[model samples]
Target: MTQSMEDFITDAFEQNYERIRLETGRAVTPNIKEAAREQVLLYYRRMRDVADGVTDTEVKLTLPEQRTPQQRKFTLEGVVDIVREGDRTTMYDVKTHLDADAAAGQLDQYVQQLNLYAHIWQGLRGEALDETAIIATRPTRELRQALRSGDDRVIDAAILKWRPCLNIPLDEHAVEDTVQRFGTVVDRIEERHFMPPAVEKLKAPIRPGARQPFGTAVCANCDVRFTCDSYRQFRLQTTPGMNPERVLQDAMNEYAASSEQGQWVDANMETLNRDRLPDAEDIDRGDV
Candidate 1:
């Protein structure tokens, strides 16, 4: 039997609520929860009707060290939201509940995930995917029927309105490079250089209004800030509402070769030496 939209929405929303809470270390209120529910419902509506492709569905890839023979180090996995079956298979990561302003920023780690998916597909099954896409939606009351008129026609139609930015493309060469970089990261980890790297790893920068308005620095949404040595050092070295220029500049440079929408810049911005960890550690909290 097919489940009603309400049932699926409840299940998806609850799952999202729990996953976000665990990842970000905060509580979500009823209003936020309801907004999330609406997003899930909206996603289903599009998959049911609007997409031009045939039979789009979510996917997951398991990559062992063997897949990256050059690296020969670690295994990893990624879950992709849309893999459309057709003359040429394409991958897309679906984003929901974001406004026009925030939709692009919300695509954190999508490039990495999608790249790995493409790389592994070529090795295990066949050639790389023909294309990659990110589908982000801003919901409105009349979105489902808006597709009928098309051509950004929904822009002027409704109250608390919604619009979608679809078919945002990913580059083939960039995806290949990203997959190669993933292997390099795993290769480094496997090296086991007798300690952590010289650089300090940082957390992601979150959505300004939606997830972490208070965050101005890279550690803004870090759940273990009080207990982590790296986070503590980040605080002492920087002030709130201020992002270090060096970090920002480096991120910009890295994304220079990529598209405006897909080149996401978040944390992992700055690096602190391993020698400095002792100074940043809190002995009371055992954050050494």
Candidate 2:
């Protein structure tokens, strides 16, 4: 008998999640585990229809002999999945974007990356490409809410409305330009040219085409944001006319550090009579 997708997902989740739990030596919280299960179910439901003929996944492709003025020839590497039918081929690049709309906002970036992949496939592997697409694995907010609600009807409705696959039109003509840009970035990295975007740029959308701000969508997820001057400025600008010290204290309190770590942050903040913060006094006065 064929196993149902729901049962399959449950089994797969138990096996894989257990492996991860053992490897990491960490326990998965109930909320996080459920969210992960929902994410996997969403991907499987959307992909099962179209994931046939997958020839390879985690495919590493090399683009060779890229040149920059500051550096000699070098190679760029990327991993993607390839699907084949007869002589035609398609490439799939999966990302963890918030949803299709979020993915669409940054479609041009994906197009450039895919174009580089296609160039390598055609030039190096001598393959015929039929299509290129991005599969964003994040479940929609409505679906997540419905799942949390544990209502079957709402889940079915959300599943019907969700669209995860975004077909991107590849421009092979743009490959050279993209490669040059990649080489330029590599040269900058090698030269230790670590300049970041201006504060104003971080406050604005990542690009003119995108609606999400660079600070929220990009900087928030970055590892080195706390050390970035522009991000610091961006945070200050987000709450205009606020006391810098108060803003900093609030930010520190919001960090989700491990419980095992000392409560030095809270303890230190207590030393500051937070009652003296301007906003707190204003709010208190308004209440009176």
Best by TM-score: 2
Could you tell me the lDDT of residue 63 within candidate 1? 73
Backbone collisions counted per model: 0, 0
Q: Give the TM-score of candidate 1.
A: 0.46
Per-model TM-score, in order, reads 0.46, 0.76
Q: Write the per-residue lDDT of candidate 2 for residues 240-283, one digit (tens) a residue.
A: 88998787666554453444134444433443433334576678
- Candidate 2 lDDT score at position 276: 36
Give the C-alpha lDDT of model 1: 0.51
Alpha-carbon shift of residue 253 in model 2 (angstroms): 5.6
Instruction: State the C-alpha lDDT per candidate.
Output: 0.51, 0.76
Over the stretch 1-77, how does candidate 1's per-residue lDDT look in tens digits? 12575686688678876676556544544444565676565555544443535344556677765434364655677
Q: Name the lDDT of candidate 2.
A: 0.76
